[model samples]
Target: MLFFLLLTIIICVLVMFYIKWVKVRSYWAERGVPFDPPNPFLGSLTFLMRKNPSLWMRDIYERHRSRYVGVWLFWRPALVVNTPELARNILVRDSGNFRNKFMTASTSDPIGSLNLLLTKDPAWTGIRKRVSLAFTSSKLKSVQAVAAAKSLDLVTRIHEEGVAEISLRTMFSDYTTDVFSAASLELDSNTTLTGEGAVRDITKEIMEFSLPRGLAWCAIFFWPDMAELFRVNFLPKKSTDFLRRILRAKFKAKSVELNKDPKTVLEILMQMMRKSQDQEKAYSEDCIMAQAAALLVGGYETTSSALTYITYLLAHSPRQQEKLYQELLVAEEKHGHHNMEGVIADCQYIDCVIKEALRMFPPMAWLDRVALHDYKVDDSLTIEAGTPVYVNGVGMQVDPEFYPDPYTFDPERFTAESIPYTYMPFGDGPRICIGKRYAMITLKNAIAAIILNFEVLPCPNSPKPAEAEIQKKGLFLMPGEDLKVKFISRK
Candidate 1:
């Protein structure tokens, strides 16, 4: 009698699960939407651990070729926006309905949860407004010296390390780390020269990926509930603690002279916090440190990865590389070698090459947002509040309809007027990357220095740019293998 009762309970539970699965599997089909048949357990996210999300998104775009595609993140239904018009609407035109990002972190991880990348409004608004002050034209101009110096250091490092022996990502990361540390934190980090420093160590940790770290990021991004339940942290605690210690030291030293003009990015943020305190709407130390950490992570990783891709892409496309070199030569002759102003204002081909590379390999390839209320996606469907939406930035960037021969590394495509909202490597709207100008300045300076000093060539036995391995574990669109290129001295 006992065995029969146990068997009956098991059978009933299985029936309930089967009924639930049927409804879940038919969600998009019921809504008259285009979708791939979801796996019984993983839904549309079977690609999570097996494939890079960016490549997966591109594949989905190619497969459906629809304005929107229905997908499920595990059992939860979500939408992926493919068209530029809808991307523009959700990201900018009607952004109020999608203010917060779908990605989130646990409250236990304040450093992760409070950063500009994950924080929700009205805190997001406050933090963004204050942080905007640090990236203004005049402020970026102040860091020109730092970028110029680091570019020269990069050239020296290449000469010393021998380009064939160097890992493009690591070499560029060192350069970017030095530039950001010196310009933002007022720290004289010599990682670009020695490949080691306290800050550099921190950045290296942040860049290092493992199974656990990958899972944590996956949870934070695709399964926020799991992130909260399991207490996943976006940043390692040791790194954050070290940053806090250094930050406190700097703040104490700076506080001693309150009237001094703010110089570094940290100083600007410190000033903002001081004013907030004066107004009795004080920002906490954790909040300030979170922004500092965000800038550090954003500053080094995105720019370095972009620099890596740009260099590798140029290595394979000699004709385009020559075009860029000529452009840089003209700018150098016109404004001298160290004038970043000339590179920023006059180097058109260089700009085009950078844009093309970013189009092919955007570090943060997807824009994630959640609906605050019932939202009409189109005349055909209305998604309820709390539904997650992903604007596939890379998907549209690679769409052949938008960009002819999207796989080819042609810089000329950008010389023509691009379709509106079709290319947003830095993202779109009010929450777009605040460091875009700073990043451009850094890229322009470094690329000019390298091109003017050395000619990059494709190393033998290496994979082509398009065939390069993408990181399967990382959340960002980064290289999975070492990308090496031969550099011959132009001097």
Candidate 2:
């Protein structure tokens, strides 16, 4: 009996190895897609966890230009689209055919994940109508209060933190979290400039795994089956429990508020739910948590990385820094004082600065989708239904075709005459980011306020770092080392 059992185990091992090896390789080669051969176990993402303090995704996307390159995420074949037109096709034009994104909540959060970024078809369209209306230029103009309050705290925090060597990453993170939480919840979260964490564990867990695009994000996408087999959580398990409790609590707490009057966004959502009968309606809890989670992840990371890069860029190029300061000063003088909307609207130079930074270091290194039905991009290649497709956004951002000199830091590339589909920092099409306006408000306001209040000085720790040395890690392009700056408050 023992001998037979041993023989059976050995046979099982051999078969498993055979199946895993053949499954990944044959899938892509059969499709005729250009692919890198996979490691039998680790697949194509062998260098996933290694700290590449070197290049960002621009290297990955450029290396595979002109074709959809195949990579393996542990036995799963993934395709990354390398060009701008093809990428625009993925994020826009044919977005409906490619609706469901990897790593988004699957039928679990229902209304919560039903926002345009995660959900699909009629459901995404419905909720997007309600939320997208809230982000229009007019609506964003109305929410200036949210930006002003958050900026006040940010400037004050810099004042209190006393201009020491601070990780602008952490500071900007707190500022954005405060703004997003207060706006989404409509409660005075009392987030102090020097204050510790304001909301609690729910948001903390939300951050850990929400938008991780490297190995962590891919882990949630391809290896969910393995996670299920091991009974392990890929996305933060901590967030799941906390989200349920906080959402339930908020729903319970809103009984009186809902009965009294409906003034806020949460109240508006509940009112919408009460009126709609046909579709999957977002409840108070669902609406609150969804917006909060979206803001918590997207709001902080996008704006923070943008701000971090801006500072790094400015610190290295003193001539550029002074030129911007003069521009801001002239704009402020014309406006009679500094206000975010006025400053952002009136100053074309500052717009250039922000746009240039976004061009070089986009927050999202890559974006993806899954085809719901078999589709053909051209006569030669036809991807079947459920095949994963992606655009390496970082590639498009750095492509010299769009921007004459992609590497040079000049903000004038976003002129009114600029062509469409060239830049996609907040994505595009029907599934573009709902909070794009809010992110702009956060980044622009923070930049304007920081420049107006303090002159960022180079750190004494080292000689001036090169423009390239200030580069980053993670799915979002960021500063690799702490881009330290001294805050000399202009009196």
Candidate 3:
């Protein structure tokens, strides 16, 4: 009797496995969805380890243009937006049809769900509204001095700290972190001038999203329960706590200063929060703190990466660097000092150069989204509710069709009129990056200042970017090795 019972249990387990396998198989097949065959578990991402996923996404989209291609993320159906029109529809024109982003995770941890990028709620829109005020034209100008002054110090540091060789990523990180810290949390990062390294370390601590967190994120698609078991959160618990402590302390300090003086992002949010009597429009101090954390995460790495990639591009192309240097010289001569406004405004060629670099290397590899309900790009495709959709932002930027001879770097593509929808360094749509103004200004200022003052050359041992591309393995397309360049200070 016991042996017979064991046999029955074994059959039941096999049947359940068979059922699950059939469901994943039938998910897209039933809808006649055009898609690549998925790996048993890893979905289309099986090749993610070998090739840049953005490249793969772009290739697949281009190959199958005018049709939706269904791929899998570990048995779950993930739709890759192929045509640019469909991409615009899903990302912008009719974005409400796909309101949420498409990353998965176990819902076991509280802090994990606290992030705006990860959470789903009306509160997100509210928070977005409040944060939007921080980066207005006037507000961006308010922080321009901070970014410019910090960059000046960065150039000084670059010259002082062995201008011979240095990591672009580290230096850019120092520059942007200082600007972001002061602007967002109202804290001055001592690392801006001295490279003291503590501020970045603390920020890293807050944002690192350690091994447990990564595993948690990986597990999220497979099962949220596992995320709970692992307590995997993208932001480290200690880091969040530290950020909270720092933000709270700084907010208090800024509050004291605001009583005597002027407006800042922090001061504005505090005033709004304190003055608003409407409960629905209101957020607790903790919510305000969380919003600050989100901004820091979104604003920091992306800006730093853009600066780093620009450094790499300029280092590789000496002729372009010389051209940019002459332009900066011309602008500076007319405006008197290193004029951030005049340079970014009038330097069309420099703008092209920056746009081209952004094309070759986008800060974020892919922009992700989730279908809120069943939707079809056209008659041929109908994605199931909750299917994941990924927009290959960087890959699309470098398409040979859109910009021929894509492998070659040229800045003229952005010159006058081109196809309207092609350029997306800041993404396209309602949910585009919030600090778009600041990001552009900060990038222009840093690049313009550096190009005017220093010449970044390929170091003796430095690896060319295309050959030494970051394993291209992680969420962002990072450099495989430290992008070391010899900074020859200009006369």
Against the true structure, whose TM-score is highest?
A: 1
Rank candidates, TM-score, best first. Answer: 1, 3, 2
Please write out the lDDT profile of model 3 over residues 233-310, one tens digit for every residue: 656666667767776676566543324333466776675555443456466655565566667776778788878888
lDDT of 2 by residue, 1-491 (tens): 99999999999999998986887678778877777678888776565544331143456666666567777767766677877668777777788788777645444444334444555567666666665555666556545678776786777888888978777666776677666656655546545374455453444554442334344444444554443344433235456556556545665577533344444445545555554423453434455456545545666667777887777667666777777778778888877554667765676767778778887777675776888888886677787787677677767777777778887777656665555666777777766777777787777777877777878887776444335344323444555566677777887
Residue 139's lDDT within candidate 2 is 56
lDDT value, candidate 3, whole model: 0.70
Pick by lDDT: 1 or 2, better one: 1
Candidate 2 lDDT at 443 equals 76
Q: Which candidate, 1 or 3, has the higher lDDT?
A: 1
Q: Among all windows of ten consecutive residues in candidate 3, which has the lowest summed lDDT?
A: 254-263
Instruction: Compute the lDDT of residue 305 as modeled in candidate 3.
Output: 80
- Model 1 weakest 10-residue run by lDDT: 255-264
State each model's CA lDDT, in order.
Answer: 0.88, 0.64, 0.70
Query: Which residue runs does candidate 1 get wrong by more than 4 Å?
Result: 1-8, 256-263, 275-281
- Displacement of residue 188 (Cα, Å) in model 1 is 1.1
For lDDT, the strongest prediction is 1
